[model samples]
Target: MGPRKITAHGDKGAEVQGKIRRLGSWRRAAAMIVAVGTVWAGTVMPASADTDLPEYLTKMRAPEMWKVADGTGITVAVIDSGVKDLPELEGRVLPGVSFMEPPVSRPEEKYPVHDDFEGHGTSMIAAIVGDGSGGGPHGLAPGAKVMPIRTSIGSPMAFGAIGEAGKGVRYAADNGAKIINLSIGGWWSLDRIGPAIEYAQSKGVLVFVGMGNDGSKMSNPIAALPGAFGVGAVDINGEPLESSSNGSATDFAAFGGKVPIRCKKNTAWCMQDGGTSYATSLASASAALVWSAHPDWTANQVARVLLQTAGGPVDGAKRNDWVGYGIARPSKVLIDRQGDPGAPDTDPLASPTPQPSTPSADPAAAVPPQAESTAAESDRSWKWPALGAAVAVILGLGITGILKRRRR
Candidate 1:
């Protein structure tokens, strides 16, 4: 969660402001920010340098977290570039599938899940439930499993791939994956995206998707449907990331700020790396911890607990558009002995946005600005409201997420 400090955007008690201050009642009502222009102490910061979370390596509250989520027994499907299997992750990660096609194959590395050009996915998996075998990253839920589902490929802007990323979403849900983490994005789709999201929610899987880093362009799909939780990125200081993206699509902003990432597949000692992708992975792992602790709870209840207990100012309780329910404080859930898991049959979100129109394929479909010049509202909108998992052989999305076809 970003600092619950004061801000210039809205009132003091505004949901955003309250989150800045938090429950303990900050010393002064003053909202503070770091030199870099992002959210700091509840205020819009001025542009500055890298904003990573501060190092506070505390002892594991529940050392047993590893026993539950080695990511071996429970499957956590990661839909992104690919897993390159590093030394620390040896024997931990599943063999996994790739969407990179034949010519471009999974990176040739040793460990278990150490593949990726972006390095975001690897870092996230580590945070959620790192093996910690060789003193590697230990995940919040160590006893869980890891599921890798590769979707879409390419570099920065001009990236393109199979149009059907939805397939991956479905596959994850259909499979037995309990958690889905999506760190990727594209334009919104009511037709292609909506129904698939509904499927995941129905399956009782928790989906944690990143609200794009392009706050000025796209919209967030945190919980595309109710019950789902969207996650935003924050720095080590508990503030928002300059490029982490924001708006209503966010349900829970996370620690996406600047942090040193370990080396990728071949080498170690990574220099520069961090993004909402990694944060989402951490959020997914955090969810795993909550789920592991309360195995019987449905995805909705787990999600609600995380949001309800998330650190925030009691004065402003409404969910925000950009930062959604606020920062995800799984620690709160771990300590809340009396927390309710919520009803199993009911949905979390009050209303799911109607599906968006698709292209020429469907008879009732509208042209839709699929090629529109505008960026996705979830990504660029100033406010956001919303939420992922993976599948197996078919390589669907994380929660019963979007299931796109693998390219030939």
Candidate 2:
């Protein structure tokens, strides 16, 4: 069984402040280019021109993993801002489709499929499959190819296009993409993308999503979904990042604190940034490595191995809201030969069904017979309050106004 769900603890004022800070960063990026739940920490400050392999690669033991598998035959579709053809990712990014029109500011460009104005998707691509040419950041799985899918999420708009994001997920599934990396999330519900994620799962594709950076008690909609593997962020010490979101939806954690990335304003140097987006990318690359090594393994088996090999929570729980199965350790499977491949069709992370309860036969019960309730009744009892709490959290996040505006 998965670990029991735990309630998140933090200062309410601090959470609100963090949410404001996160929204401010998104708006700033949107000013230059559009954004969805890109989960970028924004270049806080410049770092030395040290373009060495990121600490995360070492943490995940990517070098050791590469000795066994480098994801040579796998394709990870990045569904977000388009990917740029940087030297680090040259010949690795496929010519992906764009569901949105070209940026109004860049009409001269016929195809915005490769235009990464926000630089979010480009960084994500480099994080997944960069070859480290010209002293750029080295990706975790350098042999994996990236498929870029452009959408309004990367545009200079305010709100995200949920419908377009859904379409992008479906497109990646229909294409040759074996893994779809959706490092995007939002304050609003992701109901629109549910069916598309389901479609991908049906096609033997694994989808990885980022748990947002608002420091909220619950994960964003994308991560909250079942078919998607929700990823959170951890620092070098393997502790959850301070800004990382947590909830029942979080599936795993990865190095997301101050990892190396090509500076957005200047590609000549590398800078340190952090976010759940990077964590998601690293998790997706970890899956790619395992998938490449075991090409014949079904998606379910690959997922099961990941769950089996993951590091347990610090509290000794089977899982937790903050880190889910725990930190991703692909090297365990690649080098140590750990984790069971398990059944080909069973999803290791699937929620367990609650067994029905039967009435006690003892006549010495002190409570009246009318006090007895069926299991379904007990289940329904918590449903409304849980839902009400969720709604309250959304309203507190200022999403109610957005929903009302959209309805208009």
Candidate 3:
């Protein structure tokens, strides 16, 4: 099997390529992954209707019993296209600033800034913190509020620049946002945004980001933001979304369903896995729920607990390249209530020893960082898209004789 951007060390030293793709407004960017099974794609969207939330949540539950307290009083800042006021999220999302360069008018075309043209930002916010109501997509923490910070230059990201988002994350943290969800990435091989994450961590803020959709089959940046949790997405059947990127950088996994935005009112035509961006939001929202229950935990402590208690436990001792720490289960943190949430000054993910990968070299993802399939509808793009492109040719790390690791 050919390798996509991200590959796992497989049996007999062969790289098992996993398939993946990305669907969006500008161009439908896609990737390839060679795995034991399955294929993937990018970009597909869904509606904010009530019918799809339960099944997704049930899949996330993974037979685990995590009951995180309602995440009230916490604010997760979303830095992407922008969020609109939908019925399901009415009054739940708060208004924030736009780092969208020369900026546009909202409410209508720009100013007041909550228009989700790309649809990537809208899906990410809903996945992380939407309050399940009247048949909606239930959030990882349904009660936590969101802060929208639009930064997309539009559609896909610039190949090697930070765009406008680097500034936005810092602004959100500086202005009192406790959680920042960055569901986007770029391709610049530069160490551009470090201090922002450190600065946010200092404020006791938790940052969640997506590993690039490219790495699900390529050797590139797998969302490795410092002090930020790198998240990967999986499909509804409790399987890894073939396109979900992975690496030592990945902190955890979440249900980023194969979606088709089945509209409830008018405006139909939606389906796609919100990609890795939505996955990161789910990680942020899950952390929000765990933190809301404790209210006294540090960001590190929250992350550590997630790693220790992930559902669908893995096989060996090494951290997974694809599903880092397995699927995150907030229920594990709340139901049994593990972890000490460390002092406000301590970092929970602070390793006693150095990990195998370098921290600052993440290759940056494309704009609207991640994608997801939506609503009650699911897409089989895993098989459809680019069948003719000479995509992946599995490299590095043998796929055979791979060992699994034990988790907390």
Candidate 4:
């Protein structure tokens, strides 16, 4: 995640800051945004007579690679907060659905969609496929279309949140979305969402998830879910940010810090937005670019190529804890023609086969009589602390916003 200081409105600032502090170390894990006037290192593009690319784009060589693949004919599903009708995303976003209603709902009313309440989803959508009109930052996959699915106004942590996320995944898969970008996550299990993830995988949909901003820990549940590609954040210099979460589940890293984002209210752009959320969007767009160029390739093949060609340290490690396979280098696959698109049907994750869990016929066979005393002892001491942390982060943080005007 990017470095940001939370500034609540008016008198609520102290209360919000106090609550944020109660989250303990998790406060540092919250998704971050750049303050309005901050300038990150290696992000100042030279002024030119012609339009100059955003620093992150130029560093990633997006323009040079655009000639090879621009994510044409691809649809990326952004399942987060609602996506607004931002000028940059005017024609690229498709009509989507909302899962924010109560569990028991009557069929009389229509749920709202395509209206971003917190402005997080719109920023994410812009990162994936904004057309860069009005001198806005160009998305990695400007030619790709986006399907905006509203799961929550802020974080996707409402009641039955997992079920809503599962439903969103299914909807995207059914609607011909090639890539599903989940920029929000929590510390929940995958049990509720497993079937939906399987459904997407079966439909050849590549699902990319944010690895969270919790450094050095694999805390977020979505990152551990099989078939979900966990993305981490890196700086313009291709180094993993210290705040970026790290674990075995982290699949790849992409430029997240100092990336340009559309502002929440005005038409101006912000250059300081960052976190695994933005990185996930870029990775999703990269997948779209590869898949669009190789129309014949299956999701598995595209995923394989991305992993194979990703750039990393000279040590030659297959995967690192912070960056996984390493920073996503779509240029290597698209322009350099590196990496082989392996077998289409074979799963790149290669998850282990599940074994049946048939129980014994005996009534008392599951537990030993001697361990009954210990089994009844409940040690839930961590719940209250963890819940407090979760609440603080869920209420305060989100995808970082964009800033600044393009230089010419």
* Cα lDDT of model 1 by residue, 1-408, tens digit: 443322222321243223222311111110100000111111222222222212411322244333433333456776655555666565556666554433234445232223565444565566655555443454555567777766433222102222233566677788778887766554323245446555776787777777655442233332343334566665554445556554444666666544334443323433233456656776787777777777777887777676665543223534444445555656556654434556765544442311111122211111111121222222221111111111111221222233221000
The per-residue C-alpha lDDT of model 3 at residue 95 equals: 80
Predict model 4's lDDT versus the native. 0.62
The numbered model that scores best in lDDT is 2
Ranking by lDDT: 2, 4, 3, 1
- Runs of candidate 4 with Cα error greater than 4 angstroms are 1-50, 102-111, 153-160, 262-268, 351-408
Q: What lDDT score is found at residue 331 in candidate 1?
A: 58
Evaluate all candidate structures by whole-model CA lDDT and list the values in order.
Answer: 0.47, 0.64, 0.52, 0.62
Which is better, 2 or 4, measured by lDDT? 2
- Give the C-alpha miss distance for residue 332 in model 4, angstroms: 0.8
lDDT of 4 by residue, 1-408 (tens): 332222211232242233223333544442221110111222332223225566777766788778988888999998876777766788788888887554344546444777565566777888888777655557889889999888643432343344567788999999989999987665322344555776788898998888765454533445555467778787666666655665555677887777665453433455554677788999999999999899999998898888777765334445555666667778778887888776778876563211111223312111111111111111211011344345535643331111010000
- The list of candidate 2 runs beyond 4 A from truth reads 1-51, 102-111, 187-189, 265-269, 351-408
Which candidate tops TM-score? 2
lDDT of 2 at 3: 34
TM-score of each: 0.63, 0.74, 0.68, 0.72
Question: Candidate 3 versus the native: TM-score?
Answer: 0.68
**Candidate 2's residue-wise lDDT over 294-344, tens digit each?**
999988888777777676564445666667777777887899898778777
What's the lDDT for residue 326 in model 1?
Answer: 57
> Which has the better lDDT: candidate 1, or candidate 3?
3
